[model samples]
Target: MPLHRIPVTADLIRGALDLETTPDGGLVPHRLPPRARARNTDPQLAAVEVQPSGVRLAFRTRATEVELEVRPTTRVYAAAPPRPPALYDLLVDGTLTAQSAATGGDTLTVDMTTGATELTPGPPGTVRFTGLPARLKDVEIWLPYAQKTELRALRTDAPVEPAAASGRKRWLHHGSSISHGTDAASPTAVWPAVAASLGGVDLLNLGFGGSAMLDPFTARAIRDTPADLITLKVGINIVNADAMRMRAFGPAVHGFLDTIRDGHPDTPILLISPIHCPIHETTPGPGALDLPAFAAGTLRFLATGDPGEAAKGRLTLVTIREALERIVTQRAAEGDKLAYLNGLDLYGPDDKDLPLPDDLHPDTATHRRMGERFAERVWGRDGSLEGF
Candidate 1:
């Protein structure tokens, strides 16, 4: 049977706030809005913002075989360990059915010591998924989390149309690399995506890697997006960057939440503190890549700031957790529909079997574990999000 090409339009896209038209007329999904992108100056944040953490192509089709032509640009550090290619996940009727990857496209090489970047242009490749069920069903092709992808074309054996909305509550989430899917197994394996699936909710993930720094623009973007539920995972990134001291941290958190509340005054907001990170539990950050480990083709992290800095108002995971609890408590008194969750409940100290390989980010298995725990706690019966 001859395959018919379908124009990948905005109606078939989900979870992206903006769709940037590529030079080739392809579409690049952006988790951030145009105004938010315009406001950002940090290159790190800019790169991660277009990573398409929870972005996917959604439609209804009876196709048994489908092909998606995408220009996937994967980044690699010169003189560092070679990274594996990110995966594309296909879901039929809300269940994961197949996983594959586009082998070659563009390669972005970064000079680690110097902040230099080189993009070696390459051809766009197609990711093909076959053996899908014959009956008409909802189909979703989840783009890789960290890889920058520009979708060019979609081809299928059978015709496709806009998928019916699930009528589920939209869960808007913002967090650090863990939620951005630093080392997740696949796109759908990202903790936020996983939890969204289990909870039967739509996800709008603004989990930028090393970029969830409590910026005003991020808060404004969240405030502007319509969502039935919201979650803010704070602390780890602040500790990682050693971005602020106690004097600024408190006000910053308040300001971030305040902006989100401006648009969603009564939306149930869950503020989650940092999970178990031994390096930053009591120590201040300015964390550095473990050079020796990196040289040996292994990635690890080490905190450089002094533990005593906490006395001088330097924030740590320990201190941040206490502050978050207090903030939620104070807000609740004012009749804010707010709740607090110690992120440790999602991935705590006791889960020694599932280790965070880098001393920072969770591994793929840990990501799934965290998602399962999150679903049980926040979406289960008598849960924080259940009755609210």
Candidate 2:
């Protein structure tokens, strides 16, 4: 069988380039590259740095004979950049397609026509790239880069389509860095991506590295977006960032879910807690650690242990487990359209001995394992994803 190929051209570059700036002045390209370009040009540059923001790209094409190619995906390529940071997710048509970590790269493709394209990163330094479509009338790119990187130039050769849509249901996931695939080797290798591929479902990954702290804005974002199956990997960020405590965590989660339910009333919403992090798992409250950095070496984050403040409530693994159990119990009784998956079930104490090196994120193999487990335990037998 011959593989289908989409063509490429230069006319796809007009307003299709978007850029975001980080706290430290640096550029991040969000859109995909054009199919072809003039012999010499800067490839229609869009630069960005640190603080999170949005970039847009729109295209109009009249060449029926032309196909498009967007290449060399760009986004936050490093995890720690010598400063506090924020992560971002790239969205196309209100659906999250890719996310960038302090150290991650994702490429998103979209059809032509101006719509809402958003880029939201965690903090400090992160980058996001939006890839060009295989065919287009006009193209637009959005960049949200918060650090530094050498974006040699946008290059494209051919169209790349992993699979064709076949009326299958879609799986949408929103989580912290783990779901954003912090340590995964490639976009396709991320656990969510892997699970989506295996389950034969379309994917809308809203994972935003350190940004999944049960924020109302994020929950509203998820609510506004449409999906057949939805999963939110919560806990890690709330704990790591020390965003809330037990007293507030419960209401916040309820509120977050309430907002999401407003839009996806019938969709299955799976709430996943934090994966195993030995350092903080047993700790009583807010804490941070200096682990091997994502960039060349080691990095340190603010580690504070304050039991007398709001930060204390946000810390602790026990708090997470309690809050999750409360939500699950409350919702399950009413038969509300929501479910819960324990983080330990995904990565438990039995798996803790395995070395992560980074101390925060899992590696590729673990990602694969996690994806398989998610499919087998959550998606395979569940009727919710049967149509997908």
Candidate 3:
């Protein structure tokens, strides 16, 4: 069939933290804004922050069939286990209708042991969805959460237009990789996305995979972005990065909140502590990738810091949660519309049966559970964010 080709331009995409034009007439989704991008020089951050965690392309169409040409950069870990194939999700009128995966694109191979990287180029692959209703309705193509994608083109049987404004509450969220959709089935299945769907909110997910440090640039970006509600899922990234001590963490949290408040003085802000991470619960981090497990084709994480270090002010999930609760309490006393929620409330002790496969990121089922819990606890009628 001769299909009508629509260029994949920035106007067609939404939920992206940032959009970058590719030299080859394509668009790449980035989870970090340009200003924040310049401040973080880590190559790892550069790669993962562009993984399209909650990013999706939205349009209105009456077409019964749709297709997209994508140029993806798939990562390959040398001396480590192979990763799963990336997937693209199709949603029609807010309902997940179909999913597709391309065969090839670019391959980035990394030798974790040697700290070396190599890129092997590949061509774009096509993804198609057929048998739609034909009535004009909202359509969304959610890119892979674990792969960096360069969208080349879109095709539909009928004309496509931008989706109408949902007029939903804007919920701006910032967190680590887990919130960035690690191990999620698709971009739309990310915990935050799930929560947003259940809570009836528009999500601006700033969940940078490994770059959710309390950077001033990030704070400024959040402050500038208009939002009805805001949430910061902190601690895990700081601990995993070994970025700060207890003293520094408290002040940094305060500063991050203060920056956001500069623009959204009364916007409801929720501070979420780290979820249950056995390794980092008592043991301090810097966590390391478990090479042995990785070599065996399974990704695993191990906290390397001494448990005794907690007494010395080194941060652990437990210690960080305590600190966060205290800070939020003190701030709330000052009349700030801020609240604290322990991450475990979303994923915790009772979830032992649903183990996090990598011992770091939650599994698909866990993501769904967390999302449902979050929506009920924060956005529900009598929830913490009730008035906001």
Candidate 4:
């Protein structure tokens, strides 16, 4: 039998697989099975692609890429079964196309007008994206939210190019709903994304909505991930979930940091207190709504009175402040490379005076303001958040 070889071109590659370029010149895999979809219910899937050097994924246009040198050993492990209705708009050769949905299993397939093609299959542990466009200079994967996804490994068929000599810094942040951006209109609008854009640094957002409970697993996850600068937003979720009190809060913070420091000995670790929420601001968490009424849409969870007054002696704001203060002071005394930022500085009592209809999450405007405040306080010139 004679051997036949087909020259690979962008058009040919485009014809074979269901993929598209994003507005920011990145490739997005679409028509994937439901499980691998981006979690946001919003009809958008960020771009995912391959570059000569490696793969690049972005959440914001100005977001930084966690480049992995593609080798045979390169394997990226992102949280699968991404929030669904996977939809992405791509910009290929200046042309726009919509790609949708991603499925996961032994085989991952993407659909295009051309046909359905295999994206991942064969080896139980290995997934390959082949037949790429030749003009590919860079590849990017945009996430739907400002949350961190682990890239366990990365490898390519050929040796990857040397690292770029860019002067930009990388910032890794971990937080709860505020940082995860529960209500942001788009991924790019998230606080961490906005801050990363303003600061001109790469970001690894470990912000997980309803998931930042100062858990050891999460802390270990943060420590395991690589970063140049790190920040952890604590207290809000703990208070909201009523996960812990003064007694447990301090030790949890310490243990969390201790785990991270073990992996990143000298990395700058910032501890961020919770942003202002009128309901939980002065109250202890585990607050409940009338489930039945809430479901019926007849009830509203508005913070009518001073939350502090309501919480009085139970789970007061003063208690959270004291707990965080003690943790920072103790860590500082031990010469640990940790820094603490008061949530009030970001959004305090004064801000709380404003009405929050939802009483829990902040509106988009508030999110923007919070991001700006964080940038100013932590990344400002001559800021105390230096050399962490």
Better lDDT candidate (1, 3): 1
CA RMSD of all predictions: 1.3, 12.4, 1.7, 12.5
Give residue 138's lDDT in candidate 3 (0 to 100).
Answer: 94
lDDT of 1 by residue, 1-388 (tens): 8889887899999999999998879999999999999999999999999999999999998999999988999888898777777889999888999999986689999987676999999988999998889998999999999999999889999999998888888999999998999988899999999899889899999999998899999999999999999999998989989999988998999999999999999888999998899999999999888888878888789899999879999989999999999999998999989999998999989999988988999988999999998998889854347635
* TM-score of every candidate relative to the true structure: 0.97, 0.60, 0.96, 0.59
Per-residue C-alpha lDDT of model 3 across residues 209-235, encoded as one tens digit per residue: 877889898899899888989999999
- Residue lDDT tens for model 4, 256-356: 88998988999887887776666666656675553454555533343223354433434544577767778887888898877788887877768855444
In the range 289-327, model 2's lDDT, one tens digit per residue, is 444332345543433554344344546775687679789
lDDT by candidate, in order shown: 0.91, 0.53, 0.87, 0.51
Weakest ten-residue segment in model 1 by summed lDDT: 379-388
Q: What order do candidates take by lDDT, descending?
A: 1, 3, 2, 4
Point out where model 1 deviates above 4 Å: 382-384
Better of 1 and 4 by TM-score: 1
Ranking by TM-score: 1, 3, 2, 4
In Å, residue 348's CA in model 4 sits off its true spot by 2.2
| Stretches of candidate 3 exceeding 4 Å from the true structure | 381-384
Model 4 stretches with alpha carbons more than 4 Å out: 1-141, 146-167, 290-314, 352-357, 382-388
TM-score of 3: 0.96
